[model samples]
Target: MPGYEAKAAQLAKMGADLIRPSGAPPFMLLGYAEERELIAGWAKKYGVQMFTSGQNHVRALRTLGIKKFVGATYFPERMNRVFARYFADAGFQVLALEGIDAPFAEVPKVPPEKILAFMKETAAKHKDAEGIYMLGSAWKTVEIIDRLEKETGLTVVHAGPARTWETQLRLGLRHPIQGYGRLLAEMPG
Candidate 1:
């Protein structure tokens, strides 16, 4: 991911090409949120509606009235700082931000148990946090979201479900989706 910004336009073009054939109104849900301006430009160039995981996470938190959160992820400490700043820039109070320091490719393989434990521990330490914001979509997190919310008594927002909820709303699909998380199950599309 070192040169991701340099290659973003090309990647966006490739993504647009892959999405164009679907025949429905074209849209893209970008996996990362760091390069929003560049991604928005490419999306405009491709004439596709674009949403980023980070943006959707912020939206979900705002909709849930969660202003203070503990930002967690599978990324390294550096990326965790970046995510913390991203949330702060979006007007949220990042009570704490930490990660497992896992490499990008290894994220999907991170066990669900670790994710659940990490978030719970982080949330426990940050008693003032209203929610837990878990960045990155590659990890298997949806299954543990309900458990986290139930156990921590804090809203848990993960990237994949947030983007899916936003995309569903964009596509005019407003029906509540259960079993994923509160964002999709409770928030109006």
Candidate 2:
């Protein structure tokens, strides 16, 4: 993950190529924030609508009027800084940013209870944060979203569910889904 921006862009292009033959516009949820511009520009060439997890997270935050947030993730400290910078660049005030420092392969293995505890602890420390932005899609963060929001009294946005909500909205799917989070359960999809 040292040169993730370039690697992600490369993978996005390869994915676009695979979808091109089917004549369907390429829609991807590249989890990294750093590769958005590169992938978006490339997608634009083919009139494709590229969806990155960071973009979807930012959109969901904006939709819920969360201008200040604490960013938590199942990533290393360096990647946490990258996500912090990404959110700041997108015009949000990042109150705090931290990660579990877990390896990529270990992300999926992180328990839902740990994810909940991390977010809850982060939220408690950053009481001024309007929301909690949970980064990383491969983990079981979605399952604890509602509970975290309820316990912390902070709007919670997790990457995996946010991407699904955004994609569903773009696809004209307007049904509200419960338990995942407010973005999916309450937002007008």
On TM-score, the candidate that comes out on top is 2
TM-score versus the correct structure, for each prediction:
0.77, 0.78
Give per-residue CA lDDT, model 1, range 1-189, as digits (tens): 225433445656565432211100111122234346645665676666655556567778888889999967666676566667777777889999888767879888889999999999999898999998887768898899988898999988887778777777777678777887788788564
What is the Å distance of residue 121 in model 2 from its true position? 1.2
- Model 1 stretches with alpha carbons more than 4 Å out: 1-47
lDDT for each of the candidates? 0.71, 0.69
Q: For candidate 2, report its TM-score.
A: 0.78
TM-score of 1: 0.77
Alpha-carbon RMSD, candidate 2: 6.1
